[model samples]
Target: MTLTRPETAATPPETDAAPPPRPEYPRPDRDRSERWVNLNGRWDFEADGHEGPITVPFAWESEASGVHRTWLERGVYRRTVTAPADWAGSRVVLSFGAVHHRAVVRVDGALVGEHVGGYESFEFDVTEALTPGVSAELEVSVTAPADKRAIPHGKQRSIPRDDYDGVSFTPTSGIWQTVWLEARGRTYARSVALRGDSLTGIDIAVDLAGDAPEGAEVTATVLGTGETAALTADGSGHATGRIELAEPLLWSPERPHLYRVEVRTGDDRVVAATGLRHFETRGEELHLNGERIYLRGVLDQGYWPDTGLTAPDAASLLRELELARGLGYNLVRKHLKFEEPLWLHEADRTGMLVWAEPAAPSRFSPEAAAAFEAQLPAMVERDGNHPSIVIWGLYNEEWGLDWDIPGSAARAEAAVHAYERLRELDDTRPIVENSGWSHVRTDLVDWHYYEPKLAVWKDFVARLAAGERDDFPVRLAPDFVVDKSLYGSAEVPRSGIPIVNSEYGEGFTSLERAWHLRWETQELRRHDRYAGYVYTEFADVEHEAAGLLDTWRRPKDWGGARPADVNADTVLVLDLVPLAAGADIEPPTGPLALDVHVSHHGRDSVSGAVHAAWLPAGTPVGVPVPKPEVSSGPVTAEPFRLSSAATITVPPPSGPARLLLWLADESGRVLARSFLDAAEVEPPNRRGARPGEFEDAPAPGHAWQPIAFDDS
Candidate 1:
């Protein structure tokens, strides 16, 4: 395969100015690494047209790839690996953690394996094919289409200009992940099904391809909670039994409880975890553990700058889950992508609910559908045991399906018929028809719209959630508000990172991005979205300076990144149970006419303290509109800027008020105003959470009653 990598001819002396990359991610990862060999460090690489030294795995266009800007639509990778010394007599199985789209694998030039899916694990049994003690050279050829339907590619923006702003995304292919060899015993278990049934107890099932051992005793045990069971199985490698738990804990955004499972035979042991709960949609309500559960979810496109699709390490992956949990979000809609098994494991162990999505193909024909069917199960079978995954976002924004599919008057009926198939495939999880679309059969109506983008339409949110279903979270930040107002578009930290943050806060800004928008007329053309300066950013990545943090996960280049503050939309809630940090506000006793004061940061908008009441989620607490006022001073409180800095200060209320103040910006954008001193800041969800266990919940010196769980 003559790969056209022109960059390889420029290698200098071995001791160049560039520092060598840190090869090790972390050694403690005993879960995903045990069954495979580490094929990560270095492999002999050559390009199509140029035969020279190149880094394996990383694409030639990447800095790690050691290649220049020369590009190729197709490429090949070759590496030689010898059988492990310990596996002198074992079966050597070659495994590719991931190979984009189309890859052909040959061992010693003998065509041994071919896999079509870009985002799945593929393996070939080379034990019988390769000679003993012989070094086997494996060659893999990869081809990527301009816009392939079968492959699941994420946000890979191509370069549009020759002059490098360094914001361009490089293309990828070949063995992107670890390509290693493993040894397998006869009749090894391929996959295990672990279920924590609330009613029938725990159901354990194992599936194997090879001949099962006669009288093989299958033992299943739950780690933390004392639950164990054993059953003798026949030669089919089939076994079904139940383990008993004393008291089962329900899994929720507030309390995600996972119990470890140990499955074993004479010599094999596989360990994983599952929770006892159910997630289904009944009528208008999404039911979990046989009760209604509201999912405060954010959309997360799992992408990083330096690493591309792969995270820096598991720490980076956990950061995604932890940041969402910190923001009080209960669910994360894993948008348009299927993450690696380790990601799902983190969600399961950490207790964040995952809405797994398959990459939406731009085009889907009968052949494409067949390809999807073949690959979808592999992803599900590997991830199904996870309790954290509650919903499967099979199709997104008409990726495979189309606009006309949902545009027909029979939209709900067509959707309902299509939904039956997903339900049949995975009975345990819910299916979202399309994110940000309304379907009568949808368990949840996924919607998306930028604040200013939808501000003109007015019915954007209503139309998106406008469905016949009686139950569903009608309005939630409108997929999230893309704040684009040049004056005061804002994306504040809604706790931490949202599971999704499907929408931006307000407007956006960067140095030259302004001119680009001005030329293309994207935000400029529409005279909206303030030219892609959406209100808030997670942290500024590359040239996109809207993020709360920077591209490196360090605080941004400048210091405006606030990773500590928690933000509320309509009301800011604080748990001031006496000793909590910033819990010094004294409660008022008399019938005080609390005035409302609003303000902006730089301009100093509001002046005096205003009196306001406290209102919980379902409670009825009202305060008259402060009409319009603008004042300023050294006083902490200020008058609200409906357009930009919308901060409101409230004094103690008259009655037994639990509600804080309600605020509306000039444009009626509601900002959160919470009155409860927070009880606990961050409660570990590993153990099913107890109500008052948060660090902030029982602060020093204050007598307090626990607030109803606000996690979800």
Candidate 2:
């Protein structure tokens, strides 16, 4: 079935809601109290000496900022503030959560520090520039080059590529995150890393900066669990220890239990939340806390209509998580961009699993590689403590790397280097070197195939399941092949790595969209070798209409079964295949012959019967579609149980028609349902026959062909 021009409901009006208050200590990993000041409201932005007001943290291109412009050259932010009387004895540290491309900070007309990377946080010590009871003038000059290749900007196009369309977004420039002033003692926690292991419990490491007093010791306490560990700092001021919990409350999608931690040394204390769980792949299946897991995930591009890349507030991020959970997705693939700490903190709090990726660099070069690698350690270190981030996506579709070269030695070598480098930074999580359509050395075998043909897709998956290779266009790269031998070699080589379809199916009508989702998910459920799958996206962005929700975050109903129902953790799937392709009926149409494919995932066995019925167009049948008189015989121990439904009839409709099939339990509770659009054929007039009525040449034959999706 093909649906064109899918109808969409009206979206809510855009609001000029006031920006919410930001937390003083934006970084949860290393938080501080009275010493921090939020400088996020409005700043004096001078562009070419013309002064104007621009929101500090919000991107200038975003509507949230009064100055709704794209790229600004030679912009200087000037501000002045007096130090609080209480902070007389402490040193002042100026922090910029993030600035685009490059930024240079000056205090009292003297250069203090400069930062090149746009995605990572940077700080400058302004103690010497500040005088007691005096006002300090702060100025930051930012430059964002129009050349996209100069920086590692993900999904943002300076000059649009031929393939770049509405699927992506516009570029963001200068200070998209929070900027603030922090006052601290001479000695403080510079950074911290936390990891949870089932065997060893939880490990915490603290890196102290400044002249730490002698005999200082770092003490960590697990808030509610009464678990504590203390380690004395060495001369260099670094401390490490491990805390063992009494009873492990393993974190999962169902119950996201977190252990709050407090670490203190000297006058400074750092607080963080972590979950005790392990995510690993055993053979072809993913195990969470030693139990096999089927990841039901959605592709989330962290963009807001009004705020651009930055979410307006913490509540908005929470709402997004709530929506995903309500929709039956246990995981979210943070496509390309690394999201804000607030969102990541919310994910940890709400128990949403995330696959975090670095922002993709536009092109390949030695300079680009250096810039990209320079930012990975800081990114991983800051985000490593969050348990929601289970996997790290080092590259995406070979964005900034030369993976298309023949033999692809450079790409393969780069992939291995990145994988190994990230492993050294944080060995707690697996790494996807290049998320889709390529594999040199990766923890998972992932591919992006938008195969729309159902039968062809099914045959390809079947061949993979049978441990046979097929020439079905499985390439090492999206545009070319790197290693034909390594493609689908996981199953053949019997590699313990798991497999995921990272992306698939974009832009379909409501009915077609719903049907396609069910079919693709069922295919994965039937194939136990596959670990899990992530749909193309959660919401539509710009011209990409394939999202389950519109750009405004409004939900859509595609067909009989809600998208959530089809994606639930434990549910039955009924695949109906008609025996005969063409059936001609006039006034009295009889039961149609169909081959039923019954399967269940997230459960050992399914005790259900199949029901076949017909409903007219626009009819709202109860879900899991209403059960009919034709009951399924029995379910088998096999993954997909096939049976035949013979001679179930349906009455003709006034307009267009539909045929519905439902899987119901023994108690007549509907588990799942599927339907097909029906169009009555006008019987050939024997009295005056048309020229090609019986030729069967004009109309193409209809067959059940499955669709494919991608993981990222």
Candidate 3:
């Protein structure tokens, strides 16, 4: 069922309707702790012959840079930087994190380098191209067709916020990433690839810049144990060998193991670490190594309000990955765009699983498919070595592309063909023919069930097992719904394949982008009949606000139950804006202080009444306001007033005192929850660590532990 591949779309035009190319920061300083070339700030800027302010790393359209909202059709940028005299005999490397579509680099009127691909790093060796010591003029010319549908671009919608002007879909141009100079010796290590296999403990490959030195002793030093393993290679600058590891420290969401690796060849040595593990799919579940590995993953578009497709820097990558890990997510499903290689590298180091997908082929013509096939091998070959990548998604929801299918038996035939093609190209991983389960063509049957309805999902499962839902998970023409509880717009009357929730949650953000429509409002048009609810999203992309957290990374108002969009993209209360000197405060007269108190609220279920428990830490021997009346129950009065005493204060304690409260209904039921709010009676007189502990708050993170409400 393999359909002939399509032709590549014609190269983008030379029209004067785009911005000039820019540099991207795909690589960073090996040390990574200090000293950085802030490639993201203040570059000479312009657009379509219009004078613009210098905005280095940020896109022309983002608010972070005070640049105008006006985006560019095409333009050039010029910046001046003098090379360090010590770099006399070094090769000058111009690196770019990403520039939307195409780019060309110019230095002192000499064409230095050019790059393609909006989601990969491209660099050029410019040792003999630039001046030394004196400030050399660096000019970058960029041309990008902002909103051409013909291109394989995705989700770059131009929905206006306060005003207009900026990148139409986020502008592109010079140095979108970090650009710096790297001094290479006669023989230097270019990059390293660490792969851990089930049979083999781990395999290490090194990409070198110059010729491999003869009789070079390549030694790999494992951190922690200080165990050094040595190996030899023929000549292509690659050294491969497996270590004698008894039980490899596997990387999982619950346990992330990072190993430091040092490769020494000749006199040059490179040090780095990688997380080791294996990802595969069994009969009904995805496996990490040999165990069932549930992917509490977030759908990350990887778009930044300020940086567009490119993250601000590698540190930004660390922040997102670590935050996701803290929230209990083991996987990050990169939707649409293929990330820069460094992002994959970061995933390798940070113990996060990755499901990489190329931007869908927009125009579903034979030519487009062929072009996609041509480009796909490169994408897989270059990024495939990463162990974090578990699956390859062939197509997403929007594209209506199909393959070898005809007549009544055409259901998943086309998808099966597409899935097999990807498998043929690379058999190491599973291929999801259609991401949203639009076509159940591959090993994993993917379904997106937003706003879950348990009955609908169960019935759908029944149908797949028995063939046809019959009267179970019902179907409707314009849409369908078996259970009124589910949320969806398209309903499939019959179902097949192993259920995988592709899209479930929606209406993510408090910010603008895409607004959330309630399940009832959409009339349960086409919801899922699946096994799980993957939920719409975990964080807000630039315009797509339906996220577990707002753009600021703060959790949304979910009645404080938590785990409502809990994994990944969650905001920590510790990282919140405090009410007092903490929030947008003017300089203080003295030390910052706050009245700290804790109060618990709930029902005394057995008593059918309210009860309160509170502990205070900062209450001095008060002269007045003694015996603060306190009550714990549903706020009986307006403004959610607790039936407690005058004021609740913490008792003397070294740590934050417990303020537990209980509320009950007339029938002894919990009656839901009651009102209880704590306030700062007075600020701590002195600064630094407080004497007592605090009333425990929910742990800030993205992990999901299903809450159990015992009716037992």
Candidate 4:
């Protein structure tokens, strides 16, 4: 074992109380107790017929749940509680942390348990419905129905589905999340799991609960690292062990570390949190602990104009993972929502990298494939001990497979049996089977083009990154025929694995969605056979305004462009091809050559120089632009081009302008930038504006305004 730094817990002085509405711990990796009890705040609600108090975790149609009303269906809730008077028989339980599609519960009214997915987590025991210290009556009863075909309900919707009409939203119904009461004891420790392993260590299992006696023991430890392991409990309650650790430290997205274990047995214990790494796929890229890596990812859609899927607190889920790692995103596909294990424990304390999925069911039944295969083993047994989940996804663009996975051979064998039942429940990440297209089996060959032109999305992403197109015409449902080799039974071979485009972006204007997110992230880092590209969102939810923030999370005015300057991992790829209606270089009747390169996924090799600035055609996309008007002088960095090719030139910009192009490094520091625009033709003040409007004026009634690009 070799773990360090895991102590920090001191701040607790100020007190006028009143700050516990979602006050964290909705299960921070199984946290087992200080005898829990949050149960959020104020309850006794009702629905559809309307009634009093409601905020116990938002979702009464949001607006922080003061009952924002829209379409309720069924609700209830009640309250009462009590059980804290010191020593009582134990077990109490209760839990919840998620309840959207259906619940039930009831303590002093009888019926004890019920759960039906909406996104995992559920508990009950309720210690024989309370008594030892009096007071009971809990109740619950939710519903959330407007008919979502057997229920998984991701993008919510109540009645819209002319193929996800305007990409559905609103309808989180009933208690959205958080509601506690824990306690434990009678025999405890029902589930622990762990895993780790950066070359041999941490494996533990546990699972006991209520009568676990035969050999009992269990153990685990590791916390500050005295390293412990031991196991035993087997006459059915199960146990298992491991711990090794020689060197350990490896979790990445650039150092995320984490260890803190704990476990115990008999009287129970809990506390988890892991990390060692090893995300796979070497043949076509994406490695992780073994290194390679490159998945900028974004698509979050967790939603919250005032807490719809709960989370307007707990530091806004670590400020939306520090604003998607300050916009350079190192993964976060959480799209079809299962989110909130406190946002995967803040993406395992901010090293961020998660793909996760759950919530599909729209139509296609056997009770919607058993409510979407009962939420994939309760979301891999409640987030299979997060190492910031490296991807599990399962069915997206095919919704409930009604979108027809290539004319339905039983919906492509139910998407390859939900990717072999989540690779037999946790084969440690990588699943994606049916993410953005018709891929029958998958370990990532991802796709989801949006194609808002840019010369036909860079010639369909350079012919699907040179393996010469592996399907893409996308219709979604009219007769459905996407054909992954005619419905995919298993054959994603584009040189075997790692393709990913996950979802591209379109525009409506934030400078044309920051110029199609800087030319589709510089044509997916000018293709080194891709391996990543998630864009299409990260905010703007009630009616998808194609966010880069905006739905109160703010940041949106890339007309000064700065999504970490084209999501840096070292970038610059400029062959300047513009025309999805903007012109990146045309008025050039003189010097204007171009041809630069340098994708560089960094691990070394990066000399850097390539400058070039111009800025004028309304300069504003992230401001700051002055110096250089040409330089390529010392460029080196090769991973996906740039073994030669620098060219650069400049001059001809008498009217419409804005060129920029950086690279720097070798102490000058820039490391990637690109913005073109020029022009002599189509600039009647840069047309198309609408969503939040603003090429020159109009920000008050439609409200978004941050214009500039005007050569008029």
Put down candidate 4 lDDT per residue, 356-459, tens digits, no spaces. 88878877766687679778887877888889898888888777877777777887888788789889988877888788767878878787766555766777
Off by over 4 Å in 1: 1-36, 53-57, 68-71, 130-134, 149-151, 157-170, 197-200, 211-217, 224-226, 231-238, 290-292, 407-418, 438-441, 453-506, 510-548, 554-712
**What does candidate 2's lDDT look like per residue over 1-712, in tens digits?**
0111223221112234744234435766455754677777667787764578777677777766666776565578878866676777776788887888799998889999999887888788677787547887888898887677746887766663412222457777877888887777667667777788563478888777766644577889888767899887777777888988777787766677777788777676667777777998788778778777777888888776656777665556557888887777888898877787777887887888898987867667767767777789878877888888888888776667754422456655666678788888987787887776557668887766554545555666666666675223433322332332225223233456788776655325644555566666766666667777888778766555667776667777765546676676544443442211122122234455555555444535555655666666546645545546465565433332322322333444454555666666677766665555555555546667687454322111011111232322
Locate the minimum summed-lDDT window of 10 residues in model 3.
1-10
Assess candidate 3 and give its TM-score to the true structure.
Answer: 0.61
RMSD of each: 16.1, 7.0, 16.1, 22.1
Per-residue accuracy of model 3 over 409-478 as CA lDDT, tens digit each: 3324434556666777677677777665344456565654432232333344344434453222211111
Best by lDDT: 4
**Residue 337 miss distance in model 4 (angstroms):** 9.4
- Ordered by lDDT, highest first, the candidates read 4, 2, 1, 3
| lDDT string, candidate 1, 327-430, tens digits | 44566767555676666767776777777877645444555445544556776666777788887766544444433343444433434544666766677776
**lDDT minimum window of 10 residues, candidate 2:** 697-706
Q: Cα RMSD (Å) between model 3 and the true structure?
A: 16.1
Query: How far in Å is the alpha carbon of 503 misplaced in model 3?
Result: 0.7
Q: How much lDDT does each candidate structure score?
A: 0.47, 0.66, 0.47, 0.74
lDDT, residue 317, candidate 1: 60
Ranking by TM-score: 2, 1, 3, 4
